[model samples]
Target: MIRIKRAYEEVKESDGFRILIDRLWPRGVSKEKLKIDLWLKEIAPSSELRKSFGHDPNRWEEFQSKYRDELKEKSELLIQIKKLEEKLGNISLIYSAKDEKHDNAVVLLELLNN
Candidate 1:
């Protein structure tokens, strides 16, 4: 199973394989505090896209679409992540956005699910 979670949240054992999918390291969060098993920056949206989206809920659909397109170009990373998930059993995709419901991780989780 794949799950999306905020990087600010407390770490739990149930969060089996923790992957950080943001292009940049989260602000106010240290590398050690995040406890991520994998920092898959390559699979994240480009800096331009992320900056333009700016976490605005109004632009969520557009962001998802653009991000989806970006994902299509990262097939190797996607396949690697999928294989790792299969081996890990339970996986948690962690992000640092304040808007947890409409972040890159949410969109990526949707793509992975389908």
Candidate 2:
């Protein structure tokens, strides 16, 4: 199973294989504070795309399309994530976006589902 959680949230015991998928480290969050099992920056959207979207809801559709395209070329990272998913009971993708509905994690979750 795959899950999404805000980076600001406390790392709960229930969260298995917590992974940070953002290309950049979340502002104000210390590495030690984030109990992440993996930091899969390669699986994140490209810097160009991330800057372009800027978390704008209006760019959500475009962002998803572009991100999916990027993922197609990231077979190694995708396979790593898939292996982690199979090894762990559950996988939680942690991100720092304020608008949960308009973030890359949403697209990543969808990709993992398929």
Candidate 3:
């Protein structure tokens, strides 16, 4: 199973194979506190796409489309994530967006589901 979690949330044992998908390290969230298994920077949206979206709600739809395109070019990383999912049996993608429902993790969950 796959899940998404906020970096600010307390780490839980249920969050097996925790992976931080954000391109940048979450500000103020210490490594010791996170205890993630992987940081999949390559699986995140490109720096250019991230700046273009700017986490603007108005651009959420466009952001999803553009980010999906970015992800399509990253099948190698996606395969790795899939392998981890199978091996670990559970996975949680951690992100730092203030708007949880409108974040890259949400988009990634949607993409992975389909």
Alpha-carbon RMSD, each predicted model: 0.9, 0.9, 0.8
Instruction: Name the runs in model 2 displaced over 4 angstroms.
Output: none
Error of 1 at 79 (Å): 1.0
Q: What are the per-residue Cα lDDT tens digits for candidate 1 across 1-114? A: 899989999999999999999888889999888898999999989999999999999999999999999889998887887898899888999888998788899888888888
Q: What is the C-alpha lDDT profile of model 3 across 2-113, one tens digit per residue?
A: 9999999999999999999999999998999999889998888889989999999999999999998988898888788888888889999999999987889998998787
- Show pairs that collide, candidate 1: none
Q: Which stretches in model 1 have alpha-carbon errors above 4 Å? A: none
Residue pairs that clash (backbone atoms under 3 angstroms), model 2: none
> What value of lDDT does candidate 3 attain over all alpha carbons?
0.91
Sliding window of 10 residues with minimal summed lDDT for model 3: 75-84
Who is ahead in lDDT, 2 or 3? 3
Q: Residue-wise lDDT of candidate 2 within 27-98, one digit each (tens)?
A: 998888998788988888989999999999999999999999999999888788889889887999999999
- Clash totals for all models, in order? 0, 0, 0
Candidate numbers sorted by lDDT from highest down: 3, 2, 1
Best model per TM-score: 3
Best by lDDT: 3
lDDT (0-100) at residue 52 of candidate 3?
91
Local distance difference test, per candidate? 0.90, 0.90, 0.91
